[model samples]
Target: MNHQSDQYYIDKVLDGQVNMFSVLVERYQSLVYTVVYRMLKNKEQAEEVAQDTFVKAYKALDRYRGDAKFSTWLYTIAYRKSLDALKVNKRFVSSSDIKEIGEENIELVEDALSCLQAKERKQIILDSIMKLPEDEAAIITLYYFEEKSVKEIVEIVNLTADNVKIKLYRSRKKLYSILHISRNEW
Candidate 1:
């Protein structure tokens, strides 16, 4: 949505045009869900958290002082909510299709394994990202996936520019290793 159009929608929503808020919801639903899904890795949990993120965003809309872009604010909520869910669950929830036999004995079945091919390499990279430390993952997601610049990322992640750069470097290396991609490829 254009800046003027988004601000209009937000103003309307704030002025008791509650139903109109769905437009904003529809616009951002997939982006929010993808962020939650990447972090939680469970379809059901991700859906639930995504829903909560929207609801929370709606209830807190008045508190949103327009200091950041709507996309950034929405993603910050989703990221935080996903982290809360992970903490509550006490373990990372892999996709239901994934099965584990032991610490090092887990294996993806043929169908699931196929999803890790070159075509699905991005998903594999995302899976590895989900395993990263929360701050690092947030930086990677905001900067790379969301296309937020370093200054914007600093605001969202509340890190200094230097720290964010170091984290990004370490995160890229870690993601490359976890995805089994050659460093040169990265």
Candidate 2:
């Protein structure tokens, strides 16, 4: 691990030692890739987006002010890139499908999930999260999986705190619904 702060690496890169940029990429690639994979739900597309994210960040490194944490800024870029890809892919969710996963269904699945092995439960939750719409998946992944604060998510997704909270609520319902439907397959 690079003991130096992200700013130190950023400064090194900015000073023309571009190799320092690779260190930053190595540091955050998994984080960026995870955000993209959860939203895109495809390993190949997520890999492409993750690469593009670093390239874009390298080019735009000069414009980065010290306002947000480096991870948050990189996340904002990753989130936007995922949106662009989703717009092109045009994935949609059927309301009928969501409707099938009713309000009461969440608790039933929650109970069943508690009996699952830790790794199995986490994998199930992650798989269910991937089934969400792009925006919802991103919001939920940032909030729950990445443990980002509402304000941090607001900056990453460019949503208001209230908007992030509302999406978090809706995403959980949809995730539980998806889980309920998929439960029988396990």
Candidate 3:
């Protein structure tokens, strides 16, 4: 939707036009779910957290001041909600069972990157991202996948710009390392 259209919807949402918020929801559900799934790495939990993120966003709609883009605000909620889910899940699962995303995706890429196939590279990148720390993963996903800026990331992640830069640098390094280790440079 256009900026003017979204703003109009936001006005509706803020003025007790609760159901109108679904337009916002339909617009951003995938973005929110991707953030949650990237962080939690568990489909079920990601879905739950994504649902909660929208619910929380709706309840706080009146308080939104538009200091940041509405998308940024939604992501901030999803990121925090996903982190909370991870903390709770961390207590119950063994690390290995959690499946390091880097390694899993690497295996997927092995098949796709070859002359005979094409799905491997994406999986490799995704796996490497999954292996990153939560903050790094969020930065990579937001910056690379969602095409958000450092400023937007800073607001959503509640980090300073410098920290976001550092995280992005480190994340790129980790991703390169995975590629290097896999001997699949492309």
Error of 3 at 38 (Å): 0.9
lDDT string, candidate 1, 60-97, tens digits? 99998888888788887888898899899896544332
lDDT of 3 by residue, 7-94 (tens): 7898987778778888999999998998888788778988999999999998888888888888999999999988788787773333
User: After superposition on all CA atoms, how large is the RMSD of candidate 2?
Assistant: 4.3
Best by lDDT: 2
TM-score of 2: 0.87
Ranking the candidates on lDDT from highest down gives 2, 3, 1
- TM-score for each predicted model, relative to the true structure: 0.74, 0.87, 0.82
Q: Relative to the true structure, how large is the alpha-carbon lDDT of every model?
A: 0.74, 0.84, 0.79
lDDT, candidate 2, 10-41, per-residue tens: 99999999999999999999989999998888
Clashing pairs in 3: 101-127, 102-127, 102-128, 109-120, 112-119, 112-120
At residue 43, candidate 3 shows an lDDT of: 85
The model with the greater TM-score, 1 or 2, is 2
